[model samples]
Target: MEELINSAKALNAKKLVVLCRLEPGCLGPDGIDHIDAFCQVAERALVNFNADICHWCLAPRLDKSLIEIQYSLAGKVLSRDKAIKFISSFEQDLDVIEERFEDKLTQLINQYIARKR
Candidate 1:
């Protein structure tokens, strides 16, 4: 995860969206627990980095959707004098369900970049 974040920073990315997946036995009994643990990991890795970047995590197994993990305008490198925003107003605002998973991811990335700018 740290490597991925560093890579994004290296590429001058202003935002990052992570789709987290855990092996069956390695995760907690429920999705919320998994999300909590993932947040802990992200915090540790993100603190030392000094860049204006926002990140959102999506974990279907944890019952987290794209709309639920909107970015908060709280970064040093990528702050644009605006508040955090989601890719779409909400999941219902998206027609991504008709697209392939890869296409949906592409849309999310595009939306994030567009909204952040």
Candidate 2:
């Protein structure tokens, strides 16, 4: 989880989305408990990092196979297609994401400079 946070930082990510396989009852009576514990760890790590990044966890429902997106820090549920798109984007290129982030920062900085001038 620390590795994940570090990776996100390295990539200059404004947000981090984690995808995990979650079969509630399949793992037995303690499955959901374990999942909850794991999510808690992720939440704590994100909070402790104290960055301006948002953290989300995407877990698939075994019964329906639908994606469940949750805010890691707030435990709020979010979207499905967007979650899949986020995962796909990550799988495509980490370097590209970093480059895009840098580009956006540069653009914002340029805007600020222009406003000041």
Candidate 3:
């Protein structure tokens, strides 16, 4: 998750956001345009497979924390290795998780931009 978010940030995710149920269930995180590409890359990295995020970024029974990570990492991936390493030892690296959460932050920025537009 950290790796993906860092990549998105590096890629210039102006507004990263997640589309999910308030409780987090069948619903999942999704980006409009840029976020999609960013997650596509991130998800691919994690599981080592090509998937259809648009068709099904959501899982039937995934935990909310997973959703949080997905939603939190969209357009803020600064570096792959950095994120992977950080996510690898999440409990020990609070800074990394906080930094990765920028994806959600990016979403906030997008909301403001949409309003402006």
Candidate 4:
């Protein structure tokens, strides 16, 4: 998490978004209720970072074989995609997700900096 914060700082980003995959049945019997609790814990842990922190939980649709993503920043939903399909193994999928996320974050930071100028 510190590494992520440092990366955001290096990019001059005022906001930091963390993405994590929520595997099916990993949340125990409580299921959806645990998500809120987890988010609260995360918020507390990240409060000292001095940047707008957004955590997104990604879940895969087993039946449809697609990824569902929903993320919000400053109480506004920024992006939600339900049709993301991964055709590679688990490790490769993670690499792809990381690359895609880094690219998007770079673009967003660049746009924000341009707007400020």
Q: Please tell me which predicted candidate would have the highest TM-score against the true structure.
A: 2
- Runs in model 2 deviating more than 4 A are 1-21, 24-29, 48-54, 58-63, 68-117
Candidate with maximal lDDT: 2
For residues 26-47, could you state the per-residue lDDT of candidate 4 as single tens digits? Answer: 3445445454444344445444
List the RMSD of every prediction in angstroms: 13.3, 17.9, 13.5, 16.0
**lDDT per residue (tens digit) for residues 38-117 in model 2:** 44443454442313343434243555555433422223343644544554554644345445544643453344334434
Candidate order, TM-score descending: 2, 4, 1, 3
Candidate lDDT (C-alpha), each: 0.38, 0.44, 0.37, 0.41
Count clashing residue pairs in model 3.
14
Q: Can you list the residue pairs that collide in candidate 4?
A: none
Ranking by lDDT: 2, 4, 1, 3
TM-score, per-candidate, Cα-based: 0.25, 0.28, 0.21, 0.27
Worst 10 residues of 2 by lDDT: 69-78
**Clash list (residue pairs), candidate 1:** 51-77, 52-77, 52-78
